[model samples]
Target: MILEPKMIEEVQAAVQEAKCLGVRGQGTKPALAMAWGETAVLSTRHLSGILAYEPNEYTFTAYAGTAVSEVITTLAQNNQYLPFDPLWVEAGATLGGTVAANASGSGRYRYGGVRDFILGVSFVDGSGQLVRGGGKVVKNSAGFDIPKFMVGSLGRYGILVELTFKVFPKPRSYVTLQLQYASLHAALFAMFKLAVMPFEMDVLDLAPELAGKATLIIRLGGLPEALPGRVERMRGFLQEQTEVETAVLLENEADITYWQAQNRFDWAFAASQLVKIPVTPKQIPTLDKHLTNTLRRYSAGGNVAWVAADDMTALQTTLTELNLAGLQFTGHTDDPYLGSRKGRRFAQRIKKALDPNAVFSTND
Candidate 1:
């Protein structure tokens, strides 16, 4: 693992000499979409520090290696936050890894993902040059929007060394409401129906284990006065439609823990294949039905499904049959990644320009 020093020249040399740049924040996400064979990992831990913060402008810039926790803390102190709450608690995940992996917790359902929060970024391209994209402010649209393209690039594009995000003010109060359903089908249906209403959700997830049955966890973030009534109205409508016998009101911390587990691939699906499938909400049902025994968790918020299993070939075939693609998270030695959009010609172009030598992980 490469721990980058603060000096720009040091970063340049490391990128120049490395055969493949495995950019990692805390090595928390190494298993998913990883590259082996003569690859050198870049740990941004040492390059860490907050470069700038302008709360008034809702903007903050930090080194890529800066811990996601640190940034959230700073934002909180200012009564603000990275609205797209990133999920890297135990892994010491960095800002770069969050963007590289495009990993965000359930809170993403409210506003958007890292793609929506990222205003700009700084990086050392394959050529080992220090470069910057997007302005430091919130409203600037000066040149091409390269930062977003790098948001979910998974390090195949360029090595992200620093980032700038347009932060959001913290909510006054947050409340979580969970509804127990007899099955995932029912819970998912309730979630999709609620998504269209005039509601603000910090998180929405389904937990079938402890519930002894499937359940959908819906979290609301807003002012204190508004929470009780909002929860009541939502509850009435949900109960009228589904077989929800229980509506558990979880405290703030409890809600956070539930969503983080999903974001970090926790709760012990260890050493198995963790595949991500992206499709429209309607397609989720069809795809979920195809998984013979692979336990599934569909992030109805992001239209991303997490499939866990010990088999890889079957996962690939199933995904292909459904006309979907996924990034291989964890699995056997030679598991195949479902890969990018078949016609992502523009993605290839961006990857070429940022990593002309294809110095990062090459799924191709």
Candidate 2:
């Protein structure tokens, strides 16, 4: 059954009785929230609203159930936005679920991810007690910084009720470039070089084309008057330093469409199973060599990859063999996460401390 609690007290009361509570928000990633089989669904739908927003302070607090689009809309009105570009779920994702999944988009290439922007949170622990961590203000960095620990906890420790995040002013102008390469190695070699450069890229991605061809898309955000000069300078640098065959600057609507499409993983989601794999620039060549058959896109300047594969077992086996971390976003998996065992042990310690009763489920 779905239990929607309107307030913290009600949430506590609901959690007090459930043998296990599968935290849910808008039911966007059902594979996560409902993967626990017979457990009761504790939805944050009713406990949604903006608690506080201070544009001048560059911070905002909203209920766990608040729609990400709603927060973005509010920030847009004031020329401010979440730098992390929280992944937008087509099934109407909520901010809480986004954080729980630790889903950040291509925009994170410049600034950071949800963990970096999150300043504080108010959650109901497994013990049915309300716990607050960090603070609403940016400078308030006192104590354990438990707020960030929740960034990718997947609601196993607690149910996030209220969340606070640091936001940034939107860029004045944006310039997008399509850099085409003759091969995957050539494209990734350029991507690695770009990663260490001084130029700030708002978004960077690489997608494979047919017949050993690949394309690297770079987005630059800055003042309108300075953008053209910066774009030309970067183009020249890439041409001189890397084996880039061609570079074309995207204009207007096409740029927006391409950027948005990357954020949503439009190509990967079309397949039967969609997976997000985390890999560093140094690992891209090796990872790409193994994933050539899959429809994939390398994002965050080659720090992560999103792939669409029909065989879950093969994908898991491949990831295991490569020693690359991956998380299945769609379809069934024995375990959605393929992170290191050391990381899992650390998570287990936190889980024990925050959820002694084992109230929340982590199964996929």
Candidate 3:
């Protein structure tokens, strides 16, 4: 059965009653929601709306169940946005769900991810007790830092009721430069070179092209008058200093549409399974070798890989061989986690303390 709580008290009551509860928002992540097994589902959809938004103060508090799309629209009106670029907003991803999953988009290359922007959170613990952490301001430095701890917690500790996040002023203009490389090795070499150079990139991504080639996508955001010159300089530098086969400049609508599709994961729309693996650029060459058949994109300068695969078993085996782990967001499986599991001992200790009664399903 599913319970939709419209108020804090209602959420608490639902939590207290369920022996095994699965917390969810709008069910944007079906695979994750399915991992809960036969447990009772607690939907936060009804408990939605912005509690407070202070554009001048650069922070906003909203019910966890509130849609991220709503927050983005509201922030856009004020010329401010969440720097982490919360993902799945176009598919009705909720603020709390994004926090629970720790999902961020390409822009995370600049300002950081969900954990970096979250200021505070209010949640109902496993025992149905209301708990609060952090504050609704940017300079908060007190308590157990529970807000950060809750990130990627996946509702194992508590059900988030409200969330607060800091925002930044939206950039006035943007451009993307697509640099082509003859091979993955060459592309990664260029990325390492670009990393040390003095360029403020808003997004850095790499994708495979035909014939074993690769494309390096770089986004620059700033004043409109200054963008053309910046793009030219960056493009010229890549042409002269790196093994770039071609450099194409994308601007205005083309730039916007390209990034929007990327952030939305449109390329993975047809895949049966979608998994996120944390990785470094140094490991990409080896990982790429094993994922030739999979649709993959390396984002945030190769700090993360989003893989869309048809063969979960083979993919899991490959990740295990590499000593890497992946968090599955789509497709069917007995477990949402693939390959090597990390930090289980520490997580178990925290889970015991927060949800001693095991009211929240851990899917372990």
Candidate 4:
């Protein structure tokens, strides 16, 4: 049933009768929406609209059902942005869904992930109790840091009702450079070198190029007047230190389109099983060896790899062998996650306290 609760009373009533509930938002991520089958669906689709926004304070509180695109559009109007750059794989994606999944795009390379920017959240527990956690501003919380734990929770503990986020000022201009390398090995080597440098990059991604080659795309944002010099310096360093076949500093529409297409994966893998894999730059080349036939790109400065492969069994086996974890965005899987646990003990403790009756399915 659509849990379009206009107030806390409505939410309590909705949860009161359900034995097992599958908390959902827009169902943009099909795999996650149906992760737990046979459970009653409790959609946050009705709890829409921004509750509060203070552009001057760089913070905003929105209902859980608010569309991510809506939040982004509002923030952009004030020369501010959610630094985490919530992943928008599908158009109807909600802010709550993105937080629950802990999905971020290439922009997270500079600052951090969704957990870093989240200030607080309000949710409904299994007992139909309205609860809140974290603080409204970017300061210490009054109670437990439950909001941070909610990241990647997949709606296991409770159903998120509202969320508050810390925003950042957008840069005046952006510049992107495409550096072509002979092979993935060379491209990754250059990525490692750039990672340790003092230069601040907005986005860093490595993708396949023509003839089995590789391309390293670097995006820098700042004052329009200062970007030209920074771009020249970066270009000079790469030319002198690495074997770059070509260096092209993109401007205007070209730069915008490249980054947009990267996040949307609109290149070649439009019809393949897409998965997000967590790996270090050192592990990228190794993963690339197994994914030779897949269309893939390393995002977040090589910390995350987005791969599109047709064979699920092969992909899962490869991930198991490499000792890496993966979250398949699309496709069927008995277990959606293929990775080691993080904070399992702590998560279990919180889950027990918040959902004592197991009314919600975590799909763990």
Best by lDDT: 3
| Descending-lDDT candidate ranking | 3, 4, 2, 1
Q: Would you give me the overall lDDT of model 2? A: 0.82
RMSD of 1: 2.8
* lDDT to native, each model: 0.74, 0.82, 0.88, 0.82
- What lDDT tens digits, residue by residue, belong to model 2 across residues 174-254? 879998999988888888788889888998889886478999989998788999989988888998898888778886688
Instruction: Show where candidate 2 strays beyond 4 Å.
Output: 89-91, 136-143
Error of 1 at 206 (Å): 3.5
List the candidates ranked by TM-score, beginning with the highest: 3, 2, 4, 1
Clashes of each: 1, 0, 0, 0
RMSD of 4: 2.2
Candidate 4 C-alpha lDDT tens digits along 1-364? 5456666677788788888888778887766777475457888877889989999999999998899889888998999988887776446789889999888988999999999999999888999998878774434445457788788888888888889998999988898999999998888888888988988999888987536789998999999999999988888888777899987888878887877776666764656767889888888877888878788888998999888878878887888888788887766555567655556687788788889888887654
Give per-model TM-scores: 0.89, 0.94, 0.96, 0.93
What is candidate 1's local distance difference test score? 0.74
Per-residue C-alpha lDDT of model 1 across residues 45-160, encoded as one tens digit per residue: 77888999998999988988788888888888889987776876566888888888787766777788888989888888888888788765534366567788677777677778
State the weakest 10-residue window (summed lDDT) of model 2: 136-145
| Count of clashing pairs, candidate 1 | 1
Model 1 bad stretches (over 4 Å): 1-3, 136-143, 207-213, 260-262, 300-302, 330-336, 339-344
Model 1, residue pairs in steric clash: 2-43
